[model samples]
Target: MEKKTNAEVQVNMHEEMRRAFSLLSGKWKLEIMWLLNQRLYRFGELRKEIPGITQHMLTAQLRELEADGLVLRTVFAEVPPRVEYEITQKARGLGPTMEALTAWWSEYGQSVPEKPSMRGRKAKAASSKLG
Candidate 1:
């Protein structure tokens, strides 16, 4: 077997990290996964759970996750068609890593100052312009 040089190893690692991020990166994807980590949710339920997410955005994000094999979407035929979303085993495998990341954020976020409110900033700007 040929030994990989340090540069080769670094390149491989970088590619792997990129792939992982590509699978998980998005405004709503991680939040969707976090919710599904608890239990299966109906489309409407998920929308309610995630505030400010549009129905269209949720559908798109869920489709992306389903395509990536992180989330499973099931449809049931009935009087009223029902659909549910749940994290796949592949995603469950990420539970520990997600937990660690969440824990780190909990600690780190406390030490960090709160971000300025975008809504407040926008209102202030508008008032300044009017004034």
Candidate 2:
């Protein structure tokens, strides 16, 4: 068997990164995962925990997470159906990575310059046009 070239290894790594991002992308997926990591939550509970997320969006994000094998959804058989969401073992494995990112963000975020506001940029552009 031939050893993989550096270019081939880089390409493979890039593809894997893309796949990882696809699973974790979107505004609420990471937040939802963070919450679920703490403990199991019902659909309504999750919605309440994540302020400003619509029920439709929460459901959609949970479904995507479930499909990705990072989250497990359990439905209980009873008079009133009880559904709960929990992070899977695969997702639990990401705990260390998440912790490292949080630590890095605390240090890195302070060093980064604040982004200029879009409204400020637009006002500057308008003033320049008027001049």
Candidate 3:
């Protein structure tokens, strides 16, 4: 094998990481993966768990995940034809990464104050004016 330059190696690494991220790109894919990582869920159950995702969007995201090796979709032969989704072993490999993200978020969240609610601000103003 021919030796590669440092710059060429860095570019290859960057492209590999980009390709990995591209597989998981989308507003809802990560969210869906997180939920599926925990347990199996049917189409309706997944829709209910992930708020703000429409039926069309859920279907599309699931399809994309299934296309990738990260998610597994199973269909059962039954009266109603049940279908369920679960994360593949490949996705489970991301557990450590997810834990690291959670840790980072926990540490980062402590320093940043949450935004005050608009309703609370309005109520405070009204009370001050009345007093």
Candidate 4:
């Protein structure tokens, strides 16, 4: 049996952690990655799923992930044309890590109160006063 030397193990561990952080350390990368994990989505579909993400930001983020070799972008030729994005094998490998994070979120998400939405509150108040 062969064993990894201490230095080799440390280097491997450091690289793995660095890769994880590089892929996930961003405002929308994790969110986008998780969504992509579910299934490939067209540009518009992704935009709809991630509310509050402007088109410009989403496009920029997707381009960055594509450049990092974590995402696959496919374009189809048609009358209107079609484009889709999906996680590459490298990104899909993060499935377990993402799933664990998702599990943690499910367990604690409900206990956390989301920020108040002024637009939502105002609409509710207006409707109540009208009725």
Top of the candidates by lDDT:
1
lDDT of each: 0.87, 0.86, 0.84, 0.84
Q: What is the TM-score of each candidate against the true structure?
A: 0.77, 0.73, 0.75, 0.73
* Top-TM-score structure, candidate number: 1
- Which residue pairs show collisions in model 2? none
Model 4 lDDT vs. the true structure? 0.84
Q: Give one digit per residue, the lDDT tens place, for model 2 in 1-131.
A: 99998876675877889999999998789999988888999999998888777788899999999999999999999769999999999999988877887899898989989985432112223434453
- Backbone clash count, each prediction separately: 0, 0, 0, 0
Candidate 3 deviant stretches above 4 angstroms: 1-11, 110-131
Task: Say which prediction, candidate 2 or candidate 4, comes out ahead on lDDT.
Answer: 2
lDDT of 3 by residue, 1-131 (tens): 99998876675877889999988898789888888878999999998887667788899989999998888999999989999999999999988887787799898978888885432112223434453
Q: Which digits, one per residue and each the tens of the lDDT, describe model 1 over residues 18-46?
A: 99999989878888998899899999999
lDDT of 4 by residue, 8-124 (tens): 666587778898688667767888999999899999999888767778888989999999988999999986999999999998888998899889989999998898643211222
Off by over 4 Å in 4: 1-16, 116-131
Worst 10 residues of 1 by lDDT: 118-127
